[model samples]
Target: MEWSVTNLACRRGQLRILEGVTFEVAAGEALILRGPNGAGKTTLLRCLAGLTPPLEGQINAPEDTIAYAAHADGLKAQLSVAENLAFWAAVFESDRAHAVETAIATFDLETLRDRRAGALSAGQKRRLSLARMVVTGRPIWVMDEPTVSLDVENVARFARAVEAHLARGGSALIATHIDLGLPTARVLDISPFTKLSGRQTDDPFEEAFE
Candidate 1:
């Protein structure tokens, strides 16, 4: 599936952070997002993921094909690693016989499959969160800083999983500072579309108003 965006303008409350953004990610492709802090990289990804509505423009991806992974790893603290993946698989109706198992193996979580999310170290939780993406079986992945708590080795493992997804005609749009080692990935700098109206303060939530 090809994901396309055109003239996307977005805001956090009344403050416009970005405007005139346009991009496309074709099947088997990856698009990396780059921008200075407060340039609306996360805001743009949220709009693409449909977590936030754009003030203007068109998103041409299929409604249910997008799977989003945000900066916050939204794991249920009480759920075991396996249980968490199972829950997401059910949520996305990904009834592929081995969906949950596949995800566990993909992220090397087999060792911790029975561990509660609250008990895993930061990197382990991050792996589980990304593993949730695979269980969803969505064609397009929209991730913001997905490598946050991962070590170099884990990051490479994550990159391999992404490569496998792309090999299956999946696409990804990611906002990250570190290189994911995706050889064919293209980068799009969002600074050109940034609007300073919401960047005056250092707080990311400051855009809620002025």
Candidate 2:
């Protein structure tokens, strides 16, 4: 499905962080969000994923269609690498064997299959978290800084996965500060949409009158 956002306004605790944001990602395409810290990249991704609501405007996509990967690795520390993927596969109602195997191979987690999540390094945990997104088989990926702790080789693997997903008519909305090596992907910088001074000028004339 094609994802579209129109005049989106996102807020954090009554603080308007982003406004007048608009974009679209058609099936088989990827859109990258580029901006510095506190530019509402994460907030925008969360709003798209339905973890939070947009303060205004509309998102023309269903929440269930999105597979969101936040900065934090949302893995069960006690579970083994394979077990983590297996658990998510079951949750997503996918074929446990196939999904788990695909995820492990895609993220190069085969050797760490038996290792507990807590035992893995920072990069390993991030890899597992990314693999979970793959197991869900969701059409739209809303990832926030997906390459946080990944090395160069693993990042390449992630790029391949994204390309393969798009090749299969899937779409992605990624928020990252680094280059994801996706040449064809469109870029959206969130800085322009950020609200300054925690206030919005609803009416230019009103401010003058005041």
Candidate 3:
């Protein structure tokens, strides 16, 4: 699926944080968001994912086409890796066992599939969170720092997973500071849009990522 954001203006509470933000992500492509912390990258992504309303502009995406992966893992601590993936697969109304099995294989979580989410290492937990994106079966993926705790090897695995996604005509909009081995991805810096207030906001929502 293809989606776009045009001339977006957004706010966090009463604070106007960004304006004139624009970008498009197409099937089999990735749009990489690059900007300093507190520059409203998270805020912009939140709006695009429909978690919050934008102050102005347009988003051209079909309802329920996007799957969001937040900075936090958003996993159940007591659930095992396979169980966590299964839970999300059910939530997204995708094929249950098939999606869960594919996610474990794609993320190399088979060995840890039965381990409790909270018991996994940091990188392992991150992998499980990312695997949830796979189980969603949504065409578009909107991720916020999806690789935070991953090491080099796992990062490579993640890159391959994304490659496979794009190969299947899936699109991704990701916010990250480090390179994820995506040479075809384009970078969009949101810094200038922070000029709405001539400075980043002190709003806790923006402060969290800063």
Candidate 4:
């Protein structure tokens, strides 16, 4: 899959989040979106994921070809780990048992498989959310702050999983302050575009702070 954005912009109230964020990601390639807090990284990711519309410009991709994982785990706080996965799988019409099993093993959630999602710690919850994405197995992954609150060991596992995904010809666009441990990944900074008015300005995000 290939994703292309030209002059893409987003706004939050009167604040300009992303502007002219022209970029592209092809299959098996990883692109990192790096910037400070409130630099429009999350907004850009949301736009790319089609969860939120870009006020101006365009973001083009295949239908149902993208999977998005935001900073929030997006888990139903009331459900058990297994129940949550099962629910999502059924909702998405995915292979429930296989998806849940793989996610449990990948995130080391075997012990917590039957535990309630609300009872898991922050890191565990994040792992659960990430595992949901892995199970979905979409071609393009757009993640915002995927490594947040993860310990060193979990972070290493997360990076390896990402490598494995790329090896399989999948693509990812990640926004994070942490390093993703990919040698060929390119980092783009969206800070320069923050000055643009509204979310639709024509200032393309700069390539910086790799």
- Candidate 3 structure quality by residue, lDDT tens digits, 138-198: 9998899888999999988998999899989999988999899999998988898885454
**Which lDDT tens digits does candidate 4 get at residues 40-138?**
777777777776678899877878878899767999988999889888777767888997887788788899988999999999999999988777868
User: Model 1: how far is 55 from its true place, Å?
Assistant: 0.6
* TM-score, ranked from best to worst: 3, 1, 2, 4
State TM-scores per candidate: 0.94, 0.91, 0.94, 0.88
- Give the range of the ten consecutive residues with the poorest summed lDDT in model 4: 201-210
Best lDDT goes to which candidate?
1
| Candidate 4 residue-wise lDDT at 179 | 79
Instruction: Candidate 2: list runs displaced more than 4 Å.
Output: 197-210
Give me candidate 3's TM-score against the actual structure.
0.94
Q: What is the C-alpha lDDT of each candidate?
A: 0.89, 0.87, 0.88, 0.80
By TM-score, the better pick of 2 and 4 is 2
Total residue pair clashes for candidate 2:
0
RMSD of each: 2.5, 6.5, 1.9, 5.2
Candidate 1 clash pair list: none
